[model samples]
Target: MGGDCESNVENIIEVKNLKKTYISRGHVTEALRGISFAVKKGEIFGILGVNGAGKSTTLNITIGLLTPSSGTVRIFGKNFFQHESELKNQMNIATAYADLAGNLTVYRNLKIYALMYNVPNYKKKIADLLESFGISHLADKWVGDLSAGEKTRVNLCKSLINDPELLLLDEPTASLDPSIASHVRRLILKLQKDRNMTVVFTSHNMPEVEEMCDRVALLHKGKVYMVDTPDSLVKIHTAPDLEEVFIRLAKGELEE
Candidate 1:
């Protein structure tokens, strides 16, 4: 196996033989079954799978929010568990499920996170994010008053407040209108290129995955079925697009 080979020395993320099991109410659930993958630095990698396929489970493990029953997650050449605190300082996570303080104003909420991250020139940064996201008018508005789309923008802004080297996103555009979702996609691309940030995200939106991701991992029932570029997967599966590729994989029709 290519375990910890120098070939992966340049990778920003290296997960090998990862496994997670949960025991609940006298029942056992195996969320991951020895999945392995590596993400390169400055690359936008995607984790694609249907619900309960272990995409979220894998992401949670990568971000150190959950522990694995076996295997290793290495970030920047260091074991994740051993270097979690230090590494997390350079990483951030954003989800469509907003984690903001509902009672606080948008500005207040972002300000608190900015302070936590010790962002430089935070006021200017906050103003820029508000303007960029077209949420300047909502700055003083209570977060609870914002719409789903608006809250998503706010959550995105908070994720970037730290200017993290690595960013994790969970269904960022879920439930968003096409226009707003398009804007968010463009913004993410710009951020990735401008800052050379490493991004790993989970999405069921195949078109979005095809357009934005440099590489994708297809997971099914807690195992990675395949990992490749969108075009490559399409070519391999002889499908029109990623959606079809996913469908075939789900049906157990794709062969080695």
Candidate 2:
């Protein structure tokens, strides 16, 4: 499924008949079974599914962290595999599971990534990012010594080091308290709007998905179960909210 074609919106990411299979110990697991979707530029697209439904597998493939068993991934209208390095330079990902160096100070950690990205005037970029995320005071502190919320802020700051056109976030607020999570959500929204950046994220929080996503793809048993806006899915499924839609999908109560 793809975004509105009538509007002629440009697709920043297009996944076509994507499939990924793993063979281990004479056992086979099909992580993705011909799932296809397109994410429009300048919009937040969410991938929602229960565990083992292939959410993470799909994201990893799109980010070039994993290869597909079959099918294709096209970023910016070009074959991703043909220009992975160049494409990756325009993308960055932030995840609590993908931690920064624990022994390094926040500033140092960011500097290392900035250097890797070959960011010009990296010091200024690092300083500006820390300030923007309200983590400037934590810059000198060791990443290992920071609180969970603080670390998340720093991770977000580092993600922006390259001024990426596309930002991928995996459970960006997974372990934070409500207040901190709310703050992080606001900051992400602000940055996405201010920069007009494309975002693809995976989150189990239905409310968060509904609040932030312009469109969502619901995966079930390694296939795209449905694709639509949260509100539209609710109405189309005759459900009360996105959470109910998710539940129905997970339980196989909804049909394609």
Q: How do the predictions measure up, each by TM-score? A: 0.94, 0.94
In angstroms, the error of model 1 at 232 is 0.4
Q: What's the true lDDT of residue 229 in model 1?
A: 89
Runs of candidate 2 exceeding 4 Å displacement? 1-9
Worst 10 residues of 1 by lDDT: 1-10
Model 1 error, position 219 (Å): 0.6
Q: Which stretches of candidate 1 lie over 4 Å from their true place?
A: 1-7
lDDT of 2 at 241: 96
The alpha-carbon RMSD values of the candidates against the true structure, listed in the order shown, are 2.0, 2.0
What are the per-residue Cα lDDT tens digits for candidate 2 across 11-81?
A: 88888888999999999999998888888889999999999998889888878899899988888888899
**Clash pairs (backbone) in predicted model 1:** none
